[model samples]
Target: MTSNEHELEDERALCRYCKAPVPENEWFGLEVTRPVKMPDGSTSEVDVDFLDAVFCSQEHAALWLAAPIPPTVVPQVTVFPRWTRKLQRMIERGRP
Candidate 1:
């Protein structure tokens, strides 16, 4: 691998659950293995080839193990969805 590529890989590690870049100090690693079936109809153990993830914190790790990360909150919208039919209905009802 190239030196620059190696450096880039070292600098950025995304959390497996939230997909957030983990800080240097907050770098947390986890390894996992899974079973897979080959096309030949045989089962084999498969180990992840690369770093599984670098979590932001221990809490995130625990939460990730329990469930998938929830999507981030969207504070605003640029274009109206479905022509803003829902909003229009609410406006027509004189609510929000």
Candidate 2:
């Protein structure tokens, strides 16, 4: 591949916690929720914007329940393929 030759966008998604790119079959998602006050004046859990966040495992999914909200992306860092965490992990693990 050449610098100008376009490649398919990387289809992989990373775990929200550990940031690992596990297989799709291994991907675990949990509902993003918030406490809602019902008409009866009792608090109840409701999905937040009907969104689901991904995790590599149940452990991470659980941890994410207490993790801080998503971090802001550094625009310059995201532009280069070399800086993506997924690529870095692949290099570290010696995977293609």
Candidate 3:
């Protein structure tokens, strides 16, 4: 087995979120908890449980928090084609 595979087997080397064993070449750190401002202006704490570090990669984390929630769109389905309207009339006349 490769060194990475061996490290994964070690169980102590895994990332808390993805569960992938951390590579030996990279530095690992714990996440820090920060306070978030709610819509009502009250502050709430959000813990980054994965890296245990203050934040994941700065750009990715910032974008994640700042992204707007998408608006909901409902779809309308068309039930009948023009030809099918004649079929509906046939059904109303009790034709099987």
Q: For model 1, how big is the CA root-mean-square deviation?
A: 15.6
lDDT of 1 by residue, 17-44 (tens): 7888777676677654444445465554
Which 10 successive residues of model 2 have the least lDDT summed?
Answer: 70-79
- Candidate 2 global TM-score: 0.43
Q: What is the TM-score of each candidate against the true structure?
A: 0.43, 0.43, 0.26
CA RMSD of all predictions: 15.6, 20.4, 12.9
Greater lDDT among 1 and 3 belongs to 1
What tens digits encode model 2's per-residue C-alpha lDDT throughout 1-96?
A: 654432221456678888777566788888754554454656555423234678889899889878775633222423466557778898899998
Q: How many backbone clashes does candidate 3 have?
A: 5
Tell me the whole-model lDDT of each prediction, alpha carbons only: 0.65, 0.65, 0.50
RMSD of 2: 20.4
Of candidate 1, the 10-residue stretch with the lowest lDDT total is 68-77
Considering only N, C-alpha and C atoms within 3 Å, which residue pairs clash in candidate 3? 30-52, 30-53, 31-52, 31-53, 32-53
lDDT of 2: 0.65
Alpha carbon lDDT at 39, candidate 2: 49
